[model samples]
Target: MNDSARAKPLPTPETQHYWDGAAAGELRLQRCQACSKAYFPPRPFCPACGSRGVRVFAASGKATLYSYIINHRAAPGFTAPYAIAVVQLAEGPRLMTNIIDCPQTPEALVLDMALEVAFQKLDDTITLPVFRPAGA
Candidate 1:
């Protein structure tokens, strides 16, 4: 799908830093200072420990394919035959994202494949962090 056709994310105050980091070509995630666990879908408090002492940091941007499904039906802003994927980050957080730079096929989208972060700019304000096969 074209970049303009993709739905833009509405950044909330709590999630503004995440969007900012994406625009700056960084994959930022939250880490709990209290429990030393990294997480996503940004929040002020740690889900692991319920501590507000969470800190935002740039992630390693390395991940492994955890799970995915190839959606062949066309939808708003998304073309058919795209893989909706869950990738486990090196820091231990798994997030839902799209896989790009490769064929969206069952054979191509292997389980446990190594991936790295790639930014797709939807506009001036939003740059999404998608993933692609590592070294591809």
Candidate 2:
């Protein structure tokens, strides 16, 4: 990880499991046991049905390119001309992430392109899940 890396997310009690899973190289999500709806940005209660009975499970780590912007200005912990993107996960949730291991250009980043998770170990306790073209 670079010294200028962006600020890391602080893990709270409700969201710690997700961070732990990321550190362990797994993308974890909370599913409402009652509603069976999978969600992201972990919360204490299910957004779909107001169920407190939620279970944390590993996600398939598959997604498709939904949206993006090629940033030309440098930002904290990142270089200029990088792609900031949103991926629609196979589990029916969308996540904001950086698209990695590919050219940061419009022609290279096609809409609905297949992606697979790649963990970038930022530190000892935090590993961010980024994506790259599947099998690329």
Report how far off residue 74 is in candidate 1 (Å): 1.0
- Among residues 3 or more apart in sequence or in different chains, the pairs in candidate 1 whose N, CA or C atoms overlap within 3 Å are none
TM per model?
0.95, 0.95
Q: What is the lDDT of candidate 1?
A: 0.93
| Backbone clashes counted, model 1 | 0
lDDT of 2 by residue, 1-136 (tens): 2555688988999989988998998999989999999998899899999999999999999999999999998688887898999999999999999888899999999999999988998888888999999998
Candidate 1 Cα errors over 4 Å, as ranges: 1-5
lDDT of 1 by residue, 1-136 (tens): 5645667889999999999999999999999999998888899999988999999999999999999999989877888978999999999999989999999999999999999999988888888999999999
